[model samples]
Target: MSMPIESMLLAVSLNFLVFSVSFDDMIGQSFASLVPTMAAVESAIGLAIFVITFRVRGTIVVESINCIQG
Candidate 1:
């Protein structure tokens, strides 16, 4: 049985969240001045995943042909 897309996405998001939180603390110890920079990096990665998900049709194919038509 296959998991729904929403479930998969939620799982991935949570995984990233955990990773980011851990990294945030580690980064905090070193360059405390770059918290904003770390946040922007996380945001950019999340946005990229969102875009790629929307681009997927049935199996993970990027709808390049549809993109050109639209």
Candidate 2:
């Protein structure tokens, strides 16, 4: 439903923000530096997995609800 999508979006955005800040601090570098490349890639992969799982699980949940209603 819309709720799941909205929550997933919020989670992904927050994850990206936290990853960026932590990665920068851990390497003592700014996002403009080369050190951010690996961190950015990892974050993207994690976000993708999170989104995929959310979609799959949300579909299952909604379908179940529909079944019950009918």
TM per prediction: 0.37, 0.35
Model 1 is weakest, by summed lDDT over 10 consecutive residues, at: 27-36
Task: List model 2 lDDT by residue over 1-70, tens digit each.
Answer: 3346546555655666678787765432233353345456657776785577567566435444454431
After superposition, candidate 1 runs with Cα above 4 Å error: 1-30, 58-70
lDDT (Cα atoms) of all candidates against the true structure: 0.54, 0.55
lDDT digits (tens) for residues 1-70 of candidate 1: 1235445545655565666678765543334334446556766776776676666643444454346443
Name the top TM-score candidate. Answer: 1
Q: Give the top-scoring candidate (lDDT).
A: 2
Candidate 1 versus the native: TM-score? Answer: 0.37
- Candidate 2, overall lDDT? 0.55
